[model samples]
Target: METKLKVGDKVTCDKFASLTHNFVGSIEKIYENSAVVEILEHHKDDTVVVSDFHNRAVVALNHMKKISA
Candidate 1:
């Protein structure tokens, strides 16, 4: 079993951008290509994360790519 999560895998989600793009909530549901991520907090710009592209909408799997520090 891998430490990271895969598609269709039930797990909790936490965003490091909780302070900025906090609109994303817990793991509500999973879709075919997109995960139905709920909105727990408030977010003005979801695209705050450069890795998330220019849209702060969907949290794609590739978005989980670790940013080199």
Candidate 2:
């Protein structure tokens, strides 16, 4: 089933394409194919990922899994 996501929802994003590691964030905006995520947590070793993206990332819906409260 498709995961229903909305703004402010916490999610875990899978590593894909140019991303080197998985990350956790909250959805800031949603688009047809992707959503803008405001990075909240990530692996300490992947600090560069957060810095490079400036703590924001546009991730595809398929790559995101909603975190249950």
RMSD values, in order shown: 9.1, 1.6
Could you estimate the TM-score for every candidate? 0.33, 0.86
lDDT of 1 by residue, 20-43 (tens): 533434443445555544444444
Where does model 2 exceed 4 Å of error?
none
TM-score of 1: 0.33
lDDT of each: 0.41, 0.86
Error of 1 at 50 (Å): 20
Window of ten residues with lowest summed lDDT in model 2? 14-23
Cα lDDT over the full model 1: 0.41
Q: Please report the TM-score between candidate 2 and the true structure.
A: 0.86
lDDT of 1 at 56: 30
Pairs that clash in candidate 2: none
